[model samples]
Target: MSVIRTAILGYGRSGSTLHAGPIEKNKSFHVTAVCDVDATARQKAVARFGCRPYDDYRRMLKEEPLDLVVIVTRSDQHCQMTCDCLAGGVNVLVTKPWAVNAGEAQRMVSTAKSSGKLLLPWLPARWGSDLQRLRQLVVEEQAIGTVFLVRRVEGSFATRNDWQTERRYGGGYLLNWGPHIVDPPIQLLGSPVKSVYGRLKQTINPGDVEDLFMGILTLANGILVQVEYTVSTESPPTWFLQGTRGTIVVHGTQLKMNARTPAQPSDPTQYSTMQAVPDKMLEEKLAGSLYGDEHQIYKEIAAALCGETRYPVTPASALELSRVLDAIRTSSNENRVVMM
Candidate 1:
């Protein structure tokens, strides 16, 4: 197949670093055009990639015979930009969180279906080394017997003044870091969520949006997944998983796990009189650096565009995440658990 001509809308950190870097390295894709509202960013794109740059994405879409358009703009712009690209007969790869709200997410999915173009969300954590290792230990190897809980925490002390801390731009821990932390647990559990409980607050940030958030999702299989993010704390373990017979902890790129053999049944008559003893535990640890580009979601975009494989981050999954996100917001506002 011919190289897929691609256009990226947005020249922010995510646009320049996450999308552009990978697309340039992959032979399957060619960065033919880029559009940004900022003139400086547009000029830089032209100088860096030698691609056509436009100040407006609508004009770029109209002029370029692009096969795929990657939307890495502000969170609020995701839905509308995706709709326009799909309507213009170009496939779309939207950076997560895919939309500002569930309603917008639904519309984007519908547009993609009606237009017969692929709508893929960029969820890099789904392929992250740390997450991948945890999945192998718990899901594949069953090193952690009968996993019961998964916890992910991301915390840092900072005062931000950028658009990231603004409500109008969909700036908040829930929308900003929610998708990255939430998607992996859903993939690991492999079950439908039954209920959601959440708490959202603005701590040290000077913006109107939330700087701290916690969400508890109970899956249909009874596994509880807790996702938390804060701008108040200095450090926290990035991941924690608990199972009936083992536990796993991760900090940055380092991972440590403890596993034990499940207790075997003793005499039924002694159940009331005998005291159970814990089994001998086994421990393992690893510290390694992540090859960031290996987790890039654009490779999947190229494969999907080439008809080589189905895109793993499907539109249905994106919609499910959006629904959960909306439910979390509602739960926080109403101070009650929301049933899914």
Candidate 2:
């Protein structure tokens, strides 16, 4: 398709702001229709994008001749809606935490395969410049030597009383920000996870679910990754990486690094006299902004649809992330480490 005809299945915050905005900005895509349960939202979509709007997704699927459907609905509805779109002979791009669990994610993947349609998870963070720089420094350049520990902390003193705080709706920190936070460290580690230990706590959020969560992942190479999020306190560093020969701390748009090359003393008794040393101290700017460029993902998607290139986030990789999510939730609920 020269210009992919796209329809948005949800016209809420994520649908309008995150999905529709970038898609409309891309030259390879055109917003043809929108579906939302709310009549007001449907009207808003029609006015904003000058497109046909429907109150039901099934009706939109049946009526619109769309080449792609962007499913931006609630977490629990992602799997079925994706399957419906794929079965309707349209490619699908669903929002993060694509499904409630691994089983649902697998079902969506299977349906897409059976229908011979493209399935993509909305993981735009994979294209972030900060992550690109991290990969270049940590993996490609080995600037930090052998990475032994990685920590990602994201949170602030705040509270949410929305539907997101409700567990019945697949609402919690694990499914909320977890996909974005969890995938990066794992991707940087470049190794299969051996085990996961997780913990969940309800601090300030007015819901039955947790607002604070932590996950400790042990990778196959013995690298340890720790991710902690909360709504009750001030946030620490966005990223901290500790390696055998150096340490990196992400301070806003720059990386502050301290590194040294160790030279063993000729005498065994000189161990205590070793100088407190970091031979090098450096500050490097990130490759680009940590956020923005939602359109890049849409461009890639359009190219993938046209058979020009491969999509970075594949169905198989998404399925693996779903399984990792399952393990984290199970570990938290059972209060024990879950081995992968």
Candidate 3:
């Protein structure tokens, strides 16, 4: 099997740690070049990977014979860089959220289709161990017995002074951390996000962009998934799954479940409100890790490049995520619920 020559655009934290590190580890991918405007970062890339480093991505594209270009730049730069790479006959893998907005995402998708190049979103959360285990339990084993509600919360006390805190750079919890947290629910619930109600605010963060947000997404399947994030919280449940017969709560790496025995009868007349039935609850505790599957991302990209399998992050799904994000922004701005 021939190795896929790859180039990384942007040698910052994401480009270095997430993209370059994983590609270097995977045998199927070869890092041939990296593009960054920073001379220090370029020098580090050259020393670390012994690959060509260009200050201009366009020049890199013109010079290198690359099979894939991973765009790990700012969110605002994602669309243009991706389109440019596809137009240059290089397949593209962009980090999420795919673009700054839905319109840009659609344009990127259209460009990729016209260019006949594979465009994949680097959504490593799809292969998260905690989510994988949750899927096995909730979807396969029915351990939660018809899940009705799912909540994902990420909280930290942080004051970041970087591009990530700037609005012009597409810096906000909704865009930076939103894609990862939102993808799993959308994947599980399936689409036609009936409506979205959200609130965005900035507190204890020195930025115009919001540092905290509470978004309630009502899926067509009657599942209510709440996506919440805050950079100023002390403690919050990382994951919460509630069903008719049981509930699962994940804190840190620990999973605690409480499920009641004897499925509740469907007939309302079977039980009286005044009389209490004996409670038979089963409890369980499991430990797991929540880490992005960067290796899996590389594997999928390699397979897609090799024509062995289709890339999992479809354009439609990515567009849907963008749309949902747009709606959330609108909802927060207008102070009203937005319908999908």
The lDDT leader among the candidates is: 2
Task: Give the clash count for each candidate.
Answer: 0, 0, 0
Writing each residue's lDDT as its tens digit, candidate 1 over 205-304 gives 8889888888999999999999888674567778899988778888877777777665555765556533334543544454333323433466777778
Better of 2 and 3 by lDDT: 2
- Please identify model 2 stretches exceeding 4 Å from their true place: none
Residue-level lDDT tens digits of model 3 in 156-219 = 9977888888989989888988887777777865656899999899988887998888899999
What digit string (tens of lDDT, one per residue) describes model 2 on residues 11-44?
8999989888888788898899999999998899
Worst 10 residues of 1 by lDDT: 286-295
Instruction: Show the colliding residue pairs in model 3.
Output: none
Q: Which residue segments of model 3 deviate by more than 4 Å?
A: 261-289
Clashing pairs in 2: none
Superposed Cα deviation of residue 217, candidate 1 (Å):
1.1
Rank by lDDT (best first):
2, 3, 1
lDDT of each: 0.84, 0.86, 0.84
